[model samples]
Target: MNLFKMLRCAFLLMPALFCYSQTSSGSTAVVSLEICSNESSVDLFTMLNADAVAGGVWSPSLSGGQGIFNPAVDNEGTYLYTVTTNYVTLYEVEVEVSVVDPIAATTTSTTLCSNAGPVDLIGFTNDTSNQGTWVPELSSGTSVFNPSVDEPGIYSYIASGACGTTVSEVYVEVIDTANSGISTSLSICEGSSPFNLFDALEGSPDLGGTWSPPLRNGSGYFDPQRDAPGVYSYTVGNDYCGYSSASVTVSIDQSPFAGSDAVADLCVNNGPVDLYAFLGDGPDAGGSWSPALSGGSGWFDPLTDQEGVYTYTISNGSCGMDTATVEVRLIDTNNQPNVSLAITDLSGNNSIHVQIPNRTNYHYSLDNINYQSSNSFTNLSGGKYTVYIREIEGCGFFHKEVVLLGGPKFFTPNGDGINDYWSLFDISNIDYTIKVFDRYGRPIDTFDNHSIGWDGTFNGNPLPSADYWFLVNFEDGTTKNGHFTLLR
Candidate 1:
C-alpha cells in the first residue's frame, strides 16, 4: 500500500477506535457503606475523576464517564453514562449501581410505656448510606415513628439513605398500669384476737395478704392470747399480680410490757403476807393462789400452811398474767439456852439473859426442874445452878450451867494439884483488892495484878501451915471476908 493512502486510512480509523476504547473501558468504582436509612451518601461522581474522563455529557445530566450516582433512583438498575468527543459520534459507558431497600432490614426489640410519645424508627434503620422513604406515612418521609398512634406491637418501616433502602420491623411492648399503692398489710387491737391477716388490707384491690409468724391455732388468724405479739411480715401481690413484702407491729396494753412474776419471802410461824401488798390492788390486777391457806385475815399461816412452795398467778385483764413464788423459812430454838450469872448488888439485877435470834415466844427457869416466865434470877444464893428455858412455839428447851463467884472461899496451898495456892481462882479474871493475915487480919500486901499466891510465908520466911483470914474487895465497893488454909 502507498504511504500517503495508508496514512489517510489510518487517520480515518483512529477516531472510531478511540471512541470505542473510551466507551468500553471507562473507569469504575465499587463503594460500600452502612448508614441510617433516613440519610444518604455524597454525590458519587465526586469520588471519580470526571475532569480526566473524555466525556461530552451525562445521560441523566447527573451522571458522567466516571458517573455521579443518584440515590433518587433508589432501586437497583444499570445507569448510562456518555460524552461526545468528535461531533456526531457518541461514547457510552454503563454504571451498574445496585441500590437496596434497607427498610425492614433491622431486627430489634423495643419496650415502651403505654403512655409514651412519638417513637423514632431511625435508630433501627440498618442501612444508613442510601436516601429512602419510610412506610405508613405518619412520619411522611420522616423516619421518626410514633408509638402513640402506631400502637405497641411489631411494626415495619422503610428507610432510604446514602447506604441503601431497607425495611425494618421491631418489637414494641407497652407496660400496663398495675397497683401502684405503697403497701398492703393490716394491724388491729390486741384485745381482738383471732383476726384474719388478709382482712386488714387498706387501699388494696387484692386483699389476699399472707403472713409469717403464724397464729398459735395453726390458722391464718392473729390471736393475742394464742399468737405472739411482735412485728409480723406479710406478702401480697399487687393489682398487677406482682408481690410485695412488709411488716406490722402487734403489742399489749401494759405499763411495763414485759411481765414480771411475783416473789415473796415469809418467816416460819409467821402469818401469811397479804398478797395485795405485792400484787396490784386493782380490778384488772388480781392474783390466783392454789392450795388454799388458813391464818389471820389476808395472811398465810406458815405453821399451818403447806410445806411446799406456793405459787401465785398475777393477772391483768388487758396485759395478760404472770406467776410468783413465796418461799417459807422455818427457825429453830431447841438448842440449850445461853446463860451466865454475875454476883452484883447494883439495881437488883444478878443474871444476864441470852437473846435468841428470830425467836418470838421465850420462857426462863431458875430452878433446873421448874420453868419460869422471868428471864432474870433475883436475890438468889451464889451457887452452881442450871438454867432451863424453852420457846412457847416449836422451839424446844435448853439447859446451861450458871456459876456465881462470891469472895474467894477456903483455898488450900498444901502443894496438892487441887487448890494448890491460897488464891481466888474463880475471880482471877477480875480486878480486886485482896489482903492476908495470920489469924489476925492484916494487910500483908495488897494484891492487884497477880492472884497465883500465898505460899504460907511471912516476909519471905517459911511460916508454919495455918488458916489465914483474907479480906477481898470487888470493883463495885462491895467487901467480902473469907479464910484460906496455907498447909505446906
Candidate 2:
C-alpha cells in the first residue's frame, strides 16, 4: 500500500515538473507514458489539437527493450491518439504547455553640448539620459548630450553607444541685429532767417550717441545758432558697430531797400534844393546819403551848378535804387540888355547899309570901338559884331550890346520888281558853294563863288517857290549846313 501511494504521488507531480522545465528552457512541454509487457504499441498526441500519432506495432525486442512515443505540438488545442498493440498497458502521463509575449524596439537621441557661446543649439533637450541626445556632426566638435542653437542653419545630433548610433535632424535659425542708417529733415525759410535741422536714426536702440559735422573733427550736439548758413552735413555713429550720416541745406537771404515816386520841387531863384529819400521795406531798410551831399540824404543842386533837368537816386543797397527828377526853368527879369539893330538896302543897286534908330546922345561902338554918325562907313566887313550902346543914367552908365552880322539875304524874282536876283555882297573872301535843287536834291544851279548866289532858276527856267538846302564848306575845315526858302 505504501509503495502504491508513493507511486501515485510521483505521478501527480510529473506534469508540474515537466511544465517548469519547459518554461525554464524556453521549449515545448513533454508528455510521458508507461507501457506493460502485454502492450504492443501506443500512440501519443500533442496538446494543440494535431493529428500527431499514428498506429504502429509495439515491439519489446526493439533497440532499448522498450518503446517510447513523443507528441508534436500544433496551433489548436484538440489532439488525437491511437493504440496498435492489444496487450496489458498502464498509461498515465502528464503534458505541459507554454505561451510567450512579443517584445517592441525603441531608439534614442543625444546632445553633447547645450551652450556653445555664439552658436547655441536651441529647442533641443539638454538631458543626455532622455530619449534624444545631441551629437554634433561638425568636423571641429564632439557630441553634446544637450544642445542649443544660437546661429542659423541645419543642425544634427547623434546618440552613440556600444549598440549603435542614432542621428536626429534639427534646423536652427537666428536673428541678427540690424545695421544703422539715417533719415534727415531740414526746414529753411526764405531770406536771412534761421533754419532747423532734424535727423532720425535707424536701428539705434537708445537715442544716445555722438554726432559729428562734415569737415570737422570730434563729436558733439548740433546747434543751428552756432553755425552759419550753408550746406551742413553730419554723421552719427555708435561706439561699437553702426554708423550713419546725413546732410541739410540752409539758405539765407539779405535784400536791400527800394524807393518809389520820389520828386523834388525848387524855384529857379531859390537855387538847387536837396532831394529827400524814403526807403521801402527790405533787409537794408535804413536810408543813407550818396555822393556826400552837403544838406542831407539824397540831395541835388540846380542853380550854382548844372541847370536844365537833374536826376538823383535813393537806395538802401538792395534790389534797385529809386530815382527823383528836378527841372529848372529860367525867369526873365527884363532889367538886362534890349538892344536892336537892322540892315537895309540903300538903292536898287547891290548896296546894303545898317542903321540903328533913336540913337540920340547915345555913345555907340562897333566891335569894341567908338562909332559916330559923322564917320560914315562903306564897304563894311561881313561878320558877327557886337554893337555896344551906352547911355549916361544918373552918373551910372547903362550899356547894351547887340550882335549884328551874317543876316539872311532877301530877293524877289519879279520882272517889274526890285531885288530881282539873289546875291550876297562883301562875302567874296569866304570859300562857299551854293546849290539850288527842285525839291528832289537834283542840282538845278550851282555856284562856287561866295559873291554869286541863287536866282531861283535852272537853265533860264524859273523855279517855283520852295525850301532849298544849302551846304557850305569853309577853307578853315568847318562845314555849315542850312536850309533856305525861295520867294517869287
Candidate 3:
C-alpha cells in the first residue's frame, strides 16, 4: 500500500496512532503515570500522546499493549510505545509508571489528665504520618489536643495517597484530677465522746474520699480517750489520674486537776508554814488561792492571818476549770492552866500533889522539858520547885513556883548517938540567929545557925528535961517561933 493510504487506515483503526516519513525529525512524546499497587491494568496506548499512532509495541511489554504496574511484580521505570514504517522507527512515545503501596492504618489509645497541657495527635501513632487530617477538628486548630479544653473521644486520622486512602484512630481519654478539699484544725477536751472528722474540713469537698490512719472507732469518729491527737489525712482519686490530699489537725485538751481536799494545823508560836504541804499528792501546779494570801503565796502565818477554808482553782481554755479546798486551823499557846497544889510535909521526904479540873488534857513536867501524864509527884527533897503543864494538842505551857521548908520534930541530948546534937533542918545554907528559953521564960542557951544546938545545958551545968522554945531570925527578914523537947 502507499504511505498515504496506510496512514489513513491506521487513523481510522487507532486514533492515538500516527505516521512519519524518513524526512520527518525523529522525537519521542513523553507521558507520566502514578498508579496504586491495587489498581487494575490499563492499555499503554491510552496513557500515550493522542497524536501518536497505534500498531505499536511497548518496551518491557504487556499483553495487548496493556501496561500493568504492580508493586509486587513491576519496577518503577519508563515503558515506551513505538510506531515504525517498514520496520524503521517513525513515531515513538514514553510512559513513565510509578507504583505505590498502600500504608497500613494504625490505632492507639491513651489517657491524659484534664490538667495536662497540649499534646500532638501524631505522636500517638507510629505508622501514621503528620500529613493526615483529623476527622473532628481540634480546638487547638492543628493536630495538637488540649486536654483542658478538648473533649475526649475517638479521633480519626485520614491519610490519602496514590495507593489508596487509609484511616487511623487515636482513642484519647481525659480524666479529671481528684480534689480532697481544704484542711483545718480543731480542739476538744479529753474524754469527750464521739467527734466526727468531717466537721474539721473547710470548704465544699469532693465526696468518696477515704481517711488515713483510720479513726479511733473505725467510723471516722474520734474518741478522745482512745485516739491519740495528731494530724489526720483525707485522700481521693485513683492511680490513673493521680491522687489529692488534705488534712485535719486534731488536738486533745486535758482538764486541770487540783487534787483532793486537805486540812492543816498552824501554831501561833511557830513560823510560817506552806499551805500546799497539806494538799493531796500530785496536785496541779500554777493554781490560784482564794481569799488571797499576804504575799500571794502558799505560805500561811497563824500569828498574822485568820484561819478558815482556802480554795485552790485551776483553769484552762479547752478544759474549763477545777477546784479543791484546804481547811486551816490556828492554835493559841497563851492560855494558862488553873492549877492547885497540896503539900504533905515541910521536912525530910515530902510530896507535892498538883490538881487541875482538866488534868487529863494537860501534861505535867518538873523540868520544863521532860513531861509526864500523871499530876502527882511523890519522891521529893527540900528545894524550890517550879512545875510546868503543857496542853497535849500543842496549845500552850504554864508554870508555878514554890519553896518547901524542912525540919525535925524533936531531939534528945543525954549523950545518946541518935540525939546527941540538933540544928535547924534544911537550913545549913541559910544564915540565922537563934535564942533558946526555958519553960519558965528564963534564958537557957543561945546559938546561931552555924553552931550546934544546946544539949540540955546552961552555964556548963546540966539542966532537967523540958520543952524548949526557940526564936530564929533568917537573913531573908523572916522569923520562925517553935517549941522543941530536950530530954536527958
Give a tens-digit lDDT track for model 3, residues 71-163.
Answer: 446676788778799989987867666654566678999899888889999887644458878879899877899998889999998876545
Cα lDDT, all candidates: 0.51, 0.39, 0.73
lDDT of 1 at 109: 81
* Candidate 3: pairs in clash: 16-52, 17-52, 17-53, 17-54, 18-53, 347-406
Candidate 2: count of backbone clashes, pairs at least 3 residues apart or interchain: 29
- Model 1: lDDT of residue 14: 16
For 1-488, candidate 2 gives per-residue lDDT tens digits of 11111111112221221112211122222332232212222232322123223443332222222233322222212121223345732222223222211111233322232233333332352324434444444333433222233334556655443223445555543322223344443433233223324333323422333333432323332334345545555554443334545555544333333344343334333434544432322323345544444454445444454345444444432224554444434442223344444432222332223343444535555643555543123444553334545442211123332211232455667766566666444445456565555567887766765454676678888888777766555555554444556778
lDDT of candidate model 3 versus the reference: 0.73
Worst 10 residues of 3 by lDDT: 1-10
Best by TM-score: 3
TM-score sort, best first: 3, 1, 2
* Number of colliding residue pairs in each model: 36, 29, 6
Q: What is residue 130's positional error in candidate 2, in angstroms?
A: 12
Ranked by lDDT, the better of candidates 1 and 3 is: 3
